[model samples]
Target chain A: MVDSGRAPRRGRPPVSDEQRGRQRLDISRHAVRLFAEQGVAATSGEQIARAAGVSERTLWRCFPTKESCVEPLLTKMLDAFRTVLHAWPPGVGLIEHLRTAYQPVLDSSSGEDVEAVLAVVRMTHDEPALRAAYLVLRERAEETFTEVLAERMGMPPATFEVRVQAATMNAVLKVAADEFARETVGRGITPEVLKDHREQLAHALGLVTRRLSGTDVG
Target chain B: MVDSGRAPRRGRPPVSDEQRGRQRLDISRHAVRLFAEQGVAATSGEQIARAAGVSERTLWRCFPTKESCVEPLLTKMLDAFRTVLHAWPPGVGLIEHLRTAYQPVLDSSSGEDVEAVLAVVRMTHDEPALRAAYLVLRERAEETFTEVLAERMGMPPATFEVRVQAATMNAVLKVAADEFARETVGRGITPEVLKDHREQLAHALGLVTRRLSGTDVG
Candidate 1:
């Protein structure tokens, strides 16, 4: 809050929305790359600051901790999912909407950003601190899914039926994302592999939905 | 890491397995009370150490963080659920097993433990740091449920179907507990209300299973 008042504006006056998003994404990718190369414990905030090409002060201003540097990246992923989720029309089934939008959601992010996200996620499989950050991001995503599920099913988000459905959907999506990351993120993703996710998600959702609720909205 | 050598444990030779559990529960109740009464931020580990009648060193030994002081109380509630989930035989449906086990689960914990757990969980609805801890507990519980769901359904524990069902059941259980806590813990629990939880849980599970997986085992 302090030095932003007088640091002498650099390159486009605090940046446009697009420019800010680019900066955050760029910083996250650099932070995640360093995290992947070196474990979370060994990685320092100063290292992250240098890797991200921001002043140490700016880095701290953006992220309270080195672990939190991954959060904006996770938020980018969450935002993509929410963008797809919130646009659902009542007539379309959840899985159907998800299947159609799934490719676009991942495609929306640049390759560097996607690689950074997967690196952070892969780290979460082993890192406790990062897992905490990852799960909190997921909790935020779950809230979005919960609200949408409530609306779609005509129930309060607090009600057991809606909540279970939402939580289950969130689980399904996480599994889908994890699987996709495992298969393609490091090896390189193709348009074909991306489309394959549509089928995988649909089948998983369809099986789970039939087992969970007999009614097929689609 | 700590010198228990100097402070001489006051009660009954450092407690038996059963007594150790009681001591932990007692400490947690005091911790939760101070957390609720004075606020988690304002409440000091020294204060908890004083109230629970343990050395400052012992408090640090027991709980790595002040917030984690709630873990034992949460574990008591989780243990009850796992005891119910684990004992499911091959023939019984999930809901039937849950209904039979629900009453015994709550009856197992002391009133103080139950209230402490409820206080922590209610605070989770508003507190970010505590909510992360609370969700982590649920994640642990979900792992337990996943194994049970896999066994009951004759699937691998890691399979998508089993994972989704387990996560959904976990969500349903959280909702039931939250609803139960809001209704009874503050006002005081009654036999009628406590017994009614079986009905409440049964109803939630029945609706969810029917919605999720239509084939009833019972």
Candidate 2:
């Protein structure tokens, strides 16, 4: 007999990895809606599962705890940024690369995705567990920026100037994104507003990188 | 009957405000020691009060919750930065002001104060509540930097450039401080090393500020 915990044997079709990831994200989206509507404390695993039209057992299997349900959504946002950086071409300046790659993603992402991001932001204000998760993701994002920056600068990520520039650049992006999220929550987000925010961030980070590198690429 | 909640009459000897603040800090120091020696979850309010040599009532009066015990120490460190910013001269640039103000504080702070700072840093790694406290302190620090940058640029603090500069500068200082704290814990903190770290942070922030401001300060 095949173990229930393990994947189905060769006789039956197995669940695709992409399908599983999507399902997890679907659950997270529903969980966030429930959290935003009611308080986190008032929401439960069963409620989240029902909202997503899944069994409680499946919800538990997907997320060990309710607090972790937000991870998939948060990770999506970070992953989008990483994808932008990864596709950045050589010899292209930082601002130009960010604008070209990042703009496309912002344009393609739907209104619901933006709402999910806002939910995560609002949750971070009161939920300590969620806040920790968000901060850890940010720390990892900074490290990712450091690696990309080092590659661009022809220096080790551990070098002082590279690390400093990475930190400053990371800070500028974060502050700009946070400000955008805050504004989005207060006044519904629009394409023009997001474009403006991205431009400002790219410009600010570009300025910092130029100064730290002591070069005039612009 | 007199109200027990109210302060003593004017004729009676009054507890000096400085003495009261010190008392709160003393409680926080002990609370941190208890948290470090034993895990936060394992430690209780009664134990913290006992460790602090204060009655439970007094502990409750000072702090609304057990997690808040770290606030006093965290506030002290943040206040130190604010104090330096407040005293900054008009003609001085960011690096020069930081170097001058930071060196004296480092030289004057007692070893115990340094230990307390380290405790807060260590707590931030695992404790969600403490991490929130630390982040809030960082937010305040960013605002303080914004004000300073605005003053230096002869602009209002509400300007976008000032806010972005403040955010970048705050991020640099935070990364540098976290690095220093981790190194201090792993090896040991010495006067020379502390001075070097301060200078590096000042230089990093100065470069970023100059770039953002389009100034030729360096």
TM-score, every prediction: 0.80, 0.79
lDDT of 2 by residue, A1-218 (tens): 86786864677676899999999989988988888888787998899999999999999998766877887777777777777877777656667877767863364366687677777887777876566556655766778878977877788998777788877877777677676777677677778787888888787776666543324331
Query: Lowest summed-lDDT stretch of 10 residues in model 1 chain B?
Result: B209-218
Go through the candidates in order and give the C-alpha RMSD of each one to the true structure.
6.9, 5.9
lDDT of 2 by residue, B105-218 (tens): 354367787777776787787976566556656766688888867877778997777787887777787778777777678666788778888888787776676643224432
In model 2 chain B, the worst 10-residue window by lDDT is B209-218
**Candidate 1 local Cα displacement, residue B154, angstroms:** 2.1
Candidate 1, residue B67: Cα displacement in angstroms equals: 2.2
Residue B13 lDDT in candidate 2: 78
lDDT for each residue of candidate 1 in B1-218, tens digit (9 for 90 to 100): 77757886576664578877777777888988998897887899999999999998988877767777888788888888788777766666667766667774455577766777778878877766677777767777788888877777777998866776776677667777877777775577787777777788777676545433324442
lDDT of 1: 0.74
Q: Per-residue lDDT tens digits of candidate 1, residues A129-207?
A: 7776777778778888888778777778877667666666676677777777777755677788778776777767765
In Å, residue A106's CA in model 2 sits off its true spot by 4.0
lDDT of every model, 2 decimals:
0.74, 0.75
Task: Report the error of model 1 at residue B182, Å.
Answer: 3.1
